[model samples]
Target: MLHYSRTCGTFTGMKANGTDVRPWLAALVIGVTGIAFGACDRRGADDEQVAAVEVAASWRSIAEGVRGDRIRRDAEMLADDAMAGREAGTEGFDLAASFVAERFAALGLAPLSDGSYLQEVELFWTRLLPESARITLQAGDTEIDLTIREDFVRSGGFGPGEERVDAEVVFAGHGIAAPEYEHDDFAGIDPAGVILVVLSGAPPHFETDLRAYYSSSTVKQTEAASRGALGLLVVRTPVDQRRRPWDRYLPGVGRTDMEWVDSGGVPFGGYPELAGSAVLSQGAAERLFELAGRDLSELFVHHGAGETGSFPLGVSAVLERSSDQGRTVSANVVGILAGDDPRLRDEYVVYTAHLDHLGTLDDGDDQIHNGFYDNAVGVATLLEVARAMTKLPVPPRRSILFVALTAEEKGLLGSSFFAQNPPVPIERIVANLNIDMPFLGFPIGDVEAFGVEHSTLRSSVEKAAHAAGIVLSPDSMPERVRFVRSDQFSFVQRGIPALNLKPGSISTDDSFDGPAMLADFLDNHYHRSSDAGDQPFSESGAERFARTALLTGLWVASDKDRPSWNEGDFFGEKFATGRVAPVSAP
Candidate 1:
């Protein structure tokens, strides 16, 4: 497995196998795994002016120093020239990997496998012909036919051979069976032997907060799989550009593959139809909704995705699609750090961040969507921690793993891959602290952990953040379904308690001056081009941010027991026992 140790201020690769892989690491050399939190907080007199972490000076100073020349150098090297748009398998991305490997080498990190730093992820890019879709409706002699692309899209779902069918349609409104909302879209339908037609996402026409109900693919995909249907179709009215559908197929782009998992085992029909998740056109969707006595013309206002609510419609439609689809291989970078206490070291603590981002957009723009803010920063943090942890006073009691994942943007693919294909046993991992956009400094408040309140890590988080003087952000907007959107979601799906750490929304007390800065940051750079160094960052601020990350990681790393998931998440039922696999020492 990949290995990392801090020497000086960076990580270097090392190996210490045959050491207790579980139950508190035994041979953890004390000085080898020391950590340094917030150097700005150092009380000594000889330290340089922390730059006060104030205005641009403060932000720039800390950012530059902590990030050091390496960050800038690596950013340039890892990021493509024109952003080569690092699409998987593209020569440009291979170059990008080379750059990361070089940095890992310079940082003292070692390849988990042999001498080669390249993880070599494999995948298939099946760019479909614009004409890959075909659908027709037969309500009467009207015989209405829909156009492709604009009207409807045929996302390749069938694997290998073509998946074409001529069957009656069923309108499963919302395609949801959420007992929490007291709604069952498939209340009285047998989707078997028929093509199940349902709306793909939450209804844009709904009159309430549609964020929760419509944000995740689980509604359309999971519920659809439960019912025995030959195929499934999601009625499409509009698409979210920020959330593209094609990112699912790229290498190191969707999910990591090292964990123990059954790829695609998540049957799509939470209902009972073994169908693929594809979007259906509005006109074609209307034909099926008409069966339920709903009027499309009455609700759809072409003025702009139209004003609608986020509710599920029980209308169904007829669908037919076929394509030559295939499976691909991706990897999650995994490495083990041995701890001192032989008994405690075996308990594992997994630190993860998805390395994949929206690869090349190819709208023919001269720039690449390098995903600088989306998560390259998080990956960088993982690298930094690897270095810091190596400097620990000695190996801690528990083993720490640094996992650079793929496909997290594509529904936590890399993490999911590892969950099913773990290098060790799944039961060994005790807790997971996942990072995303760590550098996107939050408002002056405690860490706003998405799922912490629902897991065993809640108290631990509060204690740790308090020690660091971090104000915990409450679940003020729980309806956003923030818990299900990141890489930690995969571990949570496996019943492992995990937490996603981020700065408070934004604060006025600090450099950026709080609320306004936070808002602009989120709306503008959270996933955009400006997230790069273009937005000034103080070296002190960077240090504070890095320190908080470094400190929190230490707290978690020292824990003896695995964290537990709370009782409320949708995926909680998967784990009958409330524990994840314990960690092991290298």
Candidate 2:
């Protein structure tokens, strides 16, 4: 009695076609005959039939209940001016937490903490005092002063109080010591008690995997510290400056940096060996090289060609820096939906999304960075999924924990804290599904799942996507290393199977340019005040994404077997213990 149509390469059905209707009619007739014949002796059969009906009804309700309007409304509420960007450790973030908690309570989900919905995270906040910062380069008879926030920016991760260092400068190529790759920058050089100057990234000609791993600032700093370096001066090349302009770093010049406090209530000692570190602007770096009678561009050319050498620049530098430190409290909002099977109910499947964004900026008239697409939409998707789960007729086999993590913008600190100190046993958490920023500007045909290649959960995600009439795609931007950048990485580091989802480039309509749209957002709106609530968005895409996520979580939670990392997977073999022996890589 209903019609169907195909529009823009997508199918829409109002009623079953003749081929589909015949099977349903036959099944109904068979069911009716069985019920009539067995009613006198099969009382349990009636109960089974009623339960089956309830299950079907519940599925229909969920499929219809997840609507676009609701998702948009929730996103607008979270991204409104009243939330003030929802930055962690501020009143705005507190308000956002309260809203999430209230929604959880209304949905009839239980609190994860002991009689509370919040997991309080104690953190140390530190900010550099630029006025008290000083740096000078002395080459022969000339002394040049570098201005803070203009020529150089002080790096975080140092303890409170001032540190003054006066040491000779040594140029260390790439500043990496990778024994695995038979590479060591400090092969014959003793950088003891000196200021080690290094380039920003690895050798341009190195293999991609090795380059990415060694190019991390953390690895470089640890290497420099091990070599007994007193301080680090990272010189920015012209290419680096072009990639990230100096103006982009100005907003964070005096902004607070946060790190989680350990269980013993002591401040976490992070990279304690390095006394001071700073990033030099391109101009400052050129001037330093000019003093040494060398061209900065030539050094870059040599490094790009995989040249490795160390030299004394005949320059001595002194750096004096101070920081203001304090402690603050932020919370991860957690709620739980209990499962059905008594034995499996203790195990958990976590759904995580960050609830924080970049706060107000001081330089612009429009200061509040309303992160509507960056994360408000993600949280909205999470809430809608939770609502749908609450309406299910039968609960999953494993418990579901919905967590809105805080301080994710601050290096996934909140998720890290939770993973280290969980409300439930760490080993009992089976899997994690993290939603960070889902692009909802247009309808997408495929979904990208980061970290899918590392675990058996790929099978589960594929099944869910098939059920939703959607296709699964691998991470399109592996160069971004997105898997290790989000909250899911914290769970992965704890040896749990996790994946982050987003819409992929492939779309249902020719009018939608998904890749270009994504690039535009990253270039123009990401972490900017322009990412406000008023921006145009596609609620249909958001609703579809939420549905896919909900189905994926359901499949994982209901399965009898626990999800595990595939044998010989890089993350599994490195992080997990007491597991199967790793097989040879294919």
Candidate 3:
């Protein structure tokens, strides 16, 4: 049997009793499984290189089976006006779900959960009572009353009681405490019985995935609550303002928030200790910093340089809010292409794309936020990947599951629910490949595979990128913390290796600037009513992305061994706790 090496996140030759068996194990793997191990002999290691090349060669034909025309058709349908943006729990979303289910049926795939294709998910919807909300800061003898929608915005309450907090405020830097990176914002400061004033993102020097983990608002709030902080006030930095304009958030000031509910009706991801929270505008943040004997600009400079220190703001803040909480239901469309191999058929490789968008707004001139590039293209790409996988000459060794999830726009609720209550046994899942808003502004010459840095799936992704004639590039905007923003994060939290690919800055045509086009899309069209189906779309780019994603999934599914987290990985050490079968071999 092939052994997983934690040292390098790869398969090697070793017995279960920790004996070295590389010589015979390598031969057995190649002869019986036709799968290549990443290890090599001394010197040039020519044999391992040849094995990788052969694998890439075999994947080329299968990758080419992805069709641009099919992807275009699916995207047009999903982004059509009649779908009303495919928001979860609406009739429009139901129509979109029906269409996806019909397409899966036509593709000859089996329903993944209970032979029904639709896995029902319950959601708790909470809307803030703007009329009842108030926020103010008191510094010694001065009092500053902040205006809602202009100065700050609050989140919906997690419980029925009216949320209220009256506590002293502390400038807790980025509000991060990661010992692995030797950074702690609460090192000498006492966080008990206070509200924390934190910056929006994480330090710039940390690696991509680690930065993403720390930059998450949920993680920051958890850290705060665990330290006995009563509330939080997140300050918008100038860097974040430049990346995402503040006006964009004005439309969502009083928007409803959603969380997936468990069997006991308790909402997931609730921080009860944190009584209230608010995000401050740049101007409001500057005012608060001025009240303390500090300047926001100086603090930003120190933060950019990865310097860590926290000081009490010597300001007390009062925040009060209430919400109307209710329940709604949505569904995840799941289908499976069973593997031909009997021994590995039960183990699964999952592919996911969110099927929901922002839905229609009440005040916009054009109400429908047709999310064509935000996720319509992503779901379309997932369908085409499924089609291409079906057209392969032989089935992959492990079952391939395709999931079109809902409520991703609402904090990845659908995926969170599915990962927690999987149709199959949780330990049977081997890996996850998720597709979100992969920008197709220009013909993509390179791609960025997030989360590959932490898992053994990197080898398969490299081979897939080579087979598809695409270069693999590093994350260009780690400050956005995208690795934790998508549905793949849900699977990653469950100890599954996951990947989310985005188009790289490289453009095939010298006349076009891919990075500029992507920036334009984000600034003008992202999550706006302008993200309609009529926008210019590159079918060729979608097809390229489909090929890369399909080949990557196939590579992992065909291997005899399962993907493993890197040795001493942050995610693995924290969440990889369970009794899981090591290999798919019998």
Per-residue lDDT for 494-517 in model 2, tens only? 889899988776655557677777
* Model 2 ranges with Cα > 4 A deviation: 1-64, 155-158, 203-213, 226-228, 236-240, 292-295, 305-314, 578-586
Model 3 accuracy (lDDT, Cα): 0.80
Report the lDDT of model 3 for residue 188. Answer: 86
- Report the lDDT tens digits of candidate 3 across residue range 281-377: 8888888888886888999999878998898988899999888888888999998899978998999999999999988875468988888887989
Could you estimate the TM-score for every candidate? 0.71, 0.84, 0.87
TM accuracy, model 3: 0.87
342-458: candidate 1 lDDT, tens digit per residue? 777666778886666656543333335676655666666666666666655465566777777765654565676666655656777777888886544432443577676666777
Steric clash pairs (candidate 3): none
Tell me the TM-score of model 1: 0.71
lDDT order of candidates, top first: 3, 2, 1
In order, candidate lDDTs are 0.51, 0.76, 0.80
Instruction: Name the regions of candidate 1 deviating beyond 4 angstroms.
Output: 1-76, 98-125, 179-182, 199-215, 235-277, 280-292, 296-330, 438-446, 467-469, 475-479, 508-541, 567-571, 576-586
For candidate 3, give the lDDT of residue 359: 86
From the highest TM-score down, the ranking of the candidates is 3, 2, 1
